[model samples]
Target: MKRLLILPLLALSLIACEKDDDSTTNDPGNNGNSNPSALTNNMISVGTDSTSLNKYSAYVATDVNTNKTYFDIFIYKDDVLDRKQYMLLHLTEIPTASKTLNWQSGANAPGAIKADEFVIYPKVNDKRWFGVYSVSGYETTGTMQATVNNGKLTLSYEDIELADEFISVNVTERKKCSGKLTFLLSDLQGLTTTAQTLDLVAE
Candidate 1:
């Protein structure tokens, strides 16, 4: 499979996806709820199609300066996710603790999460290019985990194997799509040289 869609530059046209490394952008004041408190039952199921993640907004960008932090995470129902109807989860290197990254397919190095770079633009009063879609943790083989304790962040993945390079614009072919993306890390508001975004950014 040719999962070469690193987008116009990790997200958007082909949908944003940027994962950089040499690590060390973990902020949120270093976890343990410095101010965390808002989102409750957060959810993100790709294939079986589940939705819960609410109006949490966070867009921290860095690439113009470079401590290399391009973390983005935004859920939607009204607007925000690059113009509405979205589910952007772009994180590269910013998890202060608890780790696990092992994607395949067209693997975008730097903490890996390449290909289409984890995107989606489901409809809720539409906006994001009308009908958008993506979920490339390398596209096939998966395991992009992050579970920072205390400050309660929980991004996850599993069997992911839907093909065509794990999907870039394929809508829904459902072969595999795991989930579990809770929130906290003092409510992420963090990246780049560059990566992705969501209702969760910490690249």
Candidate 2:
């Protein structure tokens, strides 16, 4: 019985030693080839009013009152699985004096005087999206999120957070700088996603 007990104890010790060896060999943190996945989408600016929207590189909006054109500016860049860059905007540059202004987030309209505007600091996860919305009380706000997918950067969001406000005049209009963007793999360079600098242009 003593011999049997000793045999089992020796086997247990050998197993423990093997486990420790395997743990050290498989340690990804200690491996020089291992890297933590981190990427960020940098937001430069968004076009809001007539002057800001006309020079946008993505899309164009038409002003009914002046029969002119406008463009919104949105620029973001990230390197996840691949190098991705995008710029999209809706061309609508009507003055805030011809239509009733109401903020719409997703499908619901949040009565607000104006949609909030802001920028998001670059971060990495998998995907990232940012946009402006009209919240309660004519309050405009912005939001951003990061998602992971096959180690790629493909994320987007465009549902407003409506604000509480009512239209008082026909000239009330609000231009929410909200849109979607995704980066493609062909834009990347190495195994690790690199940092990309995007330019901010207005139309």
Q: Using TM-score, give the best candidate's number.
A: 1
Write candidate 2's Cα lDDT for 58-82 as tens digits. 2232334444433322333422112
**lDDT for each candidate structure:** 0.40, 0.25
Q: Which stretches of candidate 2 lie over 4 Å from their true place?
A: 1-139, 161-172, 184-203
Count of residue pairs whose backbone atoms collide, per candidate: 32, 34
Candidate 1 residue-wise lDDT, 1-203, digit = tens: 11111222323332444211212221111111111132123444433445554444444434333344344444554334334344545554456676665443343332333432343223222212211124433333445566677776666654343322223554233334344556656545232222223343332
Cα error, candidate 2, residue 103 (Å): 15
lDDT of 2: 0.25
Off by over 4 Å in 1: 10-62, 65-84, 90-153, 156-179, 182-203
